[model samples]
Target chain A: MMRLITSGAGALLGGLMMLAGVTGPAAAQGTGSATLDAVKTRGQVLCGMSGSVPGFSLPDSQGVMRGLDADTCRAVTAAALGDAAKVKFVATTTQNRFTALQSGEVDMLSRSTTWTLGREGNLGLMFAWVNYYDGTGFLVKKSSGVKAAKEMDGATICVQPGTSTELAINDYYRLNKMKFTPILIQDQAEIQGAFLSGRCDAYSTDASALATFRFSQGPKADELLLLPDIISKEPLGAVVRKGDDKWFDVVRWTFAAMITAEEKGITQANVESFLTSTDPDIRRLLGIEGDMGKALGLDNKWAFNVIKAVGNLGEMWDRNITPMGVPRGINNLWTKGGLQYAPPLR
Target chain B: MADTHADPRMSSARSSPKRSMSFAWSDPAFRAIVWQVLIVGVVVGVIWYLISNTANNLAARRIATGFGFMDRIAGIPIGESMIPYNPAEHTYGRALLIGVLNTLKVAVIGVVLATLLGTVIGIGRLSKNWLVAKITAFYVETIRDIPLLLQLLFWYTLLQGLPSPKQALRIGDAVFLTNRGLKLPLLVWEWQHTMVLATLAVGLVGVFLWSKHAKQRQDATGVRPATWPIGCGLLIALPAIVGIVLGAPLEIELPVLRGFNFQGGLTISPEYFALLLGLVVYTAGYIAEIVRSGIEAVARGQWEAAGALGLRSGMVLRLIVLPQALRVIIPPMTSQYLNLTKNSSLAVAIGFQDIVSIANTTLNQTGQAIEGIAVIMAVYLTISLSISLFMNWYNAHIALVER
Candidate 1:
């Protein structure tokens, strides 16, 4: 009778402790991110993306997700699961992206999400790394004979709601002493359709997205004119839920490895030759002379696997963005006078 | 045999008398009370546990909770508003107020329109003309069967297929129809207009008093005084005379094709238009059937009795049959009204920016999903309850009064 009572008491205490651990104070203060363990067990990354975006994360003819954002997911998957193909893309809208991440529906959001103060501070999520630097662009018909956005006062513009671009356009018009009516639509396809149907005078979104849209139009691309105004800074990047510092580091370092490889003139075709190079930095990055991957709880050749799977950041951009007619102007590396700069892997 | 022959009162008292409650298992009442208490306790405990779990989970995620976000600046630009709104100058609370107003705007107009159309169609369905009856029946059946969202999308698509602003269909240069929406010249309001309108209002009060006096005089004298002459003078001629004497301003501002689109006119956006049209058309179908059933529910003898008393068909319906049918109509009518109001929430799907849409955007922007959802639920509950209370009062007013 005594042993039975003691065992029952022990079981009850263990259950209560488990419950407490699950609901502990800040996720950052928890033991570690359960995301890593979940990812390992699932053997796949549930990557959130705007699946309709042409150059960001659209599905190709073979039903394979393709774009710069898709490549970002693949790079992380290679680091996390040792195989870039072990990823499932989840189509998420602007309104549900944060919720999906918060609810643990998606492990990482590689959608073309703008990095802003409101998103980081207000939402309990963090941007891991900037993969592309873009800006809000306005697309209008060439027949309008309007040269600048200033000249197009009192224009009816089509824009998506709950976007930084919407806020930027409002601010832009207020500052320029002009007026506009924005027909807010949540779906990008609908907004584009509304624009094409002449429900609005112009369509506005990210510059890269507009470029892709125009390119996809083929012969009709000449009929549309992309305005020269960079209304808002849109630094699109990958996002991860907070309270998992270890998982956050894994994502951050994954992008850094690709960028560092780009900075070192390492191409996917030539990475195998550099695996035996005597360069100390390259050796450390590829896990030849150091245990950098051990900190992230990954294989020593995790960076090597990532490069072999998706290549460096430049190669990813060339494969996805170049076809969309988007120039790698400000998205190039620091040596090329662009914005992307990687911290030392060490 | 002698003990069984005891009096009825004595037997009742001996078998089951009123006594103080006991905790014994044999005491049925006490056992029943204990079981009920235990069940209620368990239910309350479960609710408490669930609430605590949610609170703990929210805390663990570090999600901000509360209504303090309402005071922050809302940068969402609304397309159409009945009141003044500037995203830069407005708070989230004010934006949400505008959303509520937009919802009311649609619901009020949609309710009035649906009732009018439904009643007409319901009466038409009972008409002697075969064409009229069949057409109304067809309309009711077809519209009632399709989903409201699809109907809304169809109307929106049809509106989008219209010409652009540059090539809009123009009528007399004062009205323009385009994919953007219909633009109509607005008559600028002035003090003189208000003066004329006030005189009309006073005339209405005069008519009301005159009609009451006329009814009372007829009751006393057994002879009715004519009222239409006075009504015509008060309701119609007086307002016309007031407008002429005051010279109410009649200036009209036409929509001009400015830089890229129409400017300086009352514009009806396709989103709002399609939403209203869909809601009114779909709800009228259900309401028409309710009216049909209500009229059918009235006994056929009421009509024949009035006819036998030498009353015309229209007068028979107005005097006896319709008033009786109203008791049945009103209860179901209230349900249709509530349904119309609730259906307006689907405006989010069509970009109408009703309360649900604005609240959704607000929540998404602020990252306070739980608080935002709570506000939505509370707003809807309050609105639905108020509607129910008012309809219940109206229903009671029309209900049969039993002596």
Candidate 2:
């Protein structure tokens, strides 16, 4: 009996040591691990997103989840798995986003999260690319007659707590030496209530969010106006857990393909025609005559599958966001004098 | 030959040593030890594995893991802080301390208000009047069933739905309520305020000692002391006399409506008011149930017996039932206090700038998740422990002693 107990304890200790040793090296690499390889082999992508942000990741009238970020997920699924619908969307919040990714609950996060250095370094996550260029702005009722943020010296601002927007608003006010009360709310519903019920003289958030909120405010939205003051730059992007270089490449190239396709003037409606065209860039992008996809460990026709599955960037923005009346602005292609530029496929 | 009778066990036991070993292994005591060891071993092993993996992962990602990050200047600006804080100049630790203080402020005030409100409602529920009982029951049932987060949102919305600051509802010459927040009269202190405050404090101590002496005198001499009169004299009259002697140490700083809102007085931010109201109302519901159960736990015969002694219903309740009911009420109420403290963590959700909110910003800014989580958990644990210790002492003192 004593011998058995001793042996059992020894075995348990040995097993633990082995596990520790095996996991240690894998984690140490930080990027490029078996998980990424497994995701590739499975041929399906798992996407994490917020369930309630209109024009970003909300459901459509058909109850199908469709948004600018949701389309990005679809495009990545199409590019990698050859089917846009192969991806699964997992709804998450700001507090749970990183934990879900870290725990392998989701493969990639398409939620509108800012790309911050601390997140990149500490959260064991890798940001692929910026999907939306946003900035902090305030919205208020026109009747209040507050033309700019500076006008309401002691105005109360309603903002979501634990977000970049909260800090940005505070900084903006402090820098301008304007004292204002802050109505901090956690959930989306409360933020709306606080704003609509006139608890706050101003509602501050990302410009895109303000536009979405305005559009969704039903009839009384026309009474509100978004101030033109852009306080801070918020570059929202998709993210994946660190130590997954192969999966990271897949997600990065998927977004880059969308931008490049748009830059080449290729729409989903005309993608098939472009596939047969003789233009070198178009032919290469559509994988008609190139080894680009193979280099990323995917099929040569990855871009073609993506464009066919989900339309190009322009199509996505038009379908999901144009209805909200948010102009393409800096999100447009570089050819259109916007900041969006993709590296050469070659 | 000397121990021939005792040697019988030696001979008999020696016949099945292997059997004895096997039996020992199957014994409940041995089994419990084995199981506990196995469970502990596995859990510890798993934790050790995870820790090592996290360390390796952090190293590989070039992410430093330590509290050293707490010393780094937090560039994020906090909205509301009890203390002066500049994100640009202050360390994350200082910022987190501010958050801790804010959390404590809310918890302490919420606990006191919730207790008072709950005790009243609990008594009301058992009142003879049908209207009072039903209303109390409705309040208890309605608030308890709804989620706290939802109630918080409702209260926040209700506050926001009030008129704008410019059109605030004024209750008197010194009070205003608006979507912005509640404004009340502030005490403008003079140089003599310290003397008045010190006198008030001393008088409070004197009142407490006098009450103890009065109770002892009543027990020995059968004399009924007028506790209320003495309390009023000590608490109010003494303070007033001291204030007069000190030449009226303070003046009221009444808030007056200015350009857009009330000015020159202390203002309770809408966030604070909404959070406090939500917490108090929600916690009071649970406290009411606790209080009701505590009052009910005392035997009906005890109250009847007190009445038999020619005591009125109110006096019987005040003298006999309350002391016994308190023993039952206090232990659970301690847990409620702990719950209030823990629930205050939810203040972060509503942007109340509580400890958790500040810590969250620090964590995000410093990239020190481990340290940030530690600070949050530690603060909560400390608060819980302190409340438990204080309540334990009180419980011991009030506990029934039997021969």
Model 2 error, position A18 (Å)? 19
Best-fitting candidate, scored by TM-score? 1
| Tens digit per residue, CA lDDT, model 1, B1-403 | 5786576665655665569988898999999999999999999987787667656655655667678889998877888888898888899898888888999899889999999999999988988999999999999999999988788878887899999888999997899999989999998999888887898899899999999999999999988799999999998899889898888878999999876788888999999999999999999999898888888988888888898999998899887877788888988888888899888887766678888778777877887776666677677777778888988898788777789
Quote the lDDT for A27 in model 2: 34
lDDT of 2 by residue, B239-312 (tens): 78888876874578988776446677888877788789999999999999999999999999998899899999
lDDT of 2 by residue, A70-152 (tens): 98889888877788888888876555566556546577898888888767877678999888999999999998887877786
Best by lDDT: 1
Model 1 stretches with alpha carbons more than 4 Å out: A1-31, B1-18, B25-28, B39-43, B218-221, B240-247
lDDT of 1 by residue, A1-346 (tens): 1222222232233224323334343333222557877787788989988888888888899998899999899999999889999988987777667777766668889988898888878777889999989999889989877667777688888887777888888888888877788787776776788888888888888888999999889999999999998888899889987777788898999999999999998887889999899999999889998899888888788899899999999999999999887889989999998888999988
Task: Give lDDT per model, in order.
Answer: 0.83, 0.79
Quote the true-contact fraction of every model: 0.45, 0.34
Per-prediction TM-score: 0.91, 0.86
